[model samples]
Target: MYTSFFLLSSRWSLPMMMSISHRGTGVAMSLGVSLFGLSALVLPGHFADYLDLIRSLSLGPVLIYSAKFALAFPLSFHTWNGIRHLAWDMGKGFKIPQVYQSGVLVLVLTVLSSVGIAAM
Candidate 1:
């Protein structure tokens, strides 16, 4: 059963994959925000001090850009996918073709918005 499930997952349709990804990204974003909040409450110094500490590290451009993209991609993906889920709640976009189209659209928008925001 496990093997069959794995095989099916490996060949998952677009909607299936997107649904899984949406849940995964939601969990990731929740964890990220929770950790940030916890750190804010527990850490000694102010947020500015941490910002200064990061700046003091003198991270390279590539590393900085990668970090920004990392932060941006999940946010973008989650937000767009959320709108898709909302449409589902409204009894819309249930058709197979519409599902695939919206899934592709979400991916495109996610990449575009993530890159745009990360570039800022």
Candidate 2:
């Protein structure tokens, strides 16, 4: 059974992959936010102090933008995919084609929004 699972893994559909990604991203964001929040409260310095420290490094704009995009992509993907899930709950987009289209739509929107945000 386990061997079959691995052999068939490559055949997983987009919807299947997206469903797994959605759950994974949810867990990742939850852990990240929790850790970041705890650090903000428990650490000796203010959030702005941390910001100042990062600024002191004087990283180039390309690296800074890349970092911002990396941070933004997960949140963006999760948010858009979440809305897609909500539509599913409402009994819309149940057809196979609709499912794949919605998944692609979510990816496009995630990229565009993440880029727009990181550009700021």
| Residue pairs in collision within model 2 | none
Candidate achieving the largest lDDT: 2
Clashes of each: 0, 0
Relative to the true structure, candidate 2 reaches a TM of 0.90
Which stretches of candidate 2 lie above 4 Å from their native place?
1-10
* Superposition-based RMSD of candidate 2 using all C-alpha atoms, in angstroms: 1.8
Cα miss at 16, model 2 (Å)?
1.0
TM-score of each: 0.87, 0.90
Question: RMSDs, each prediction?
Answer: 2.2, 1.8
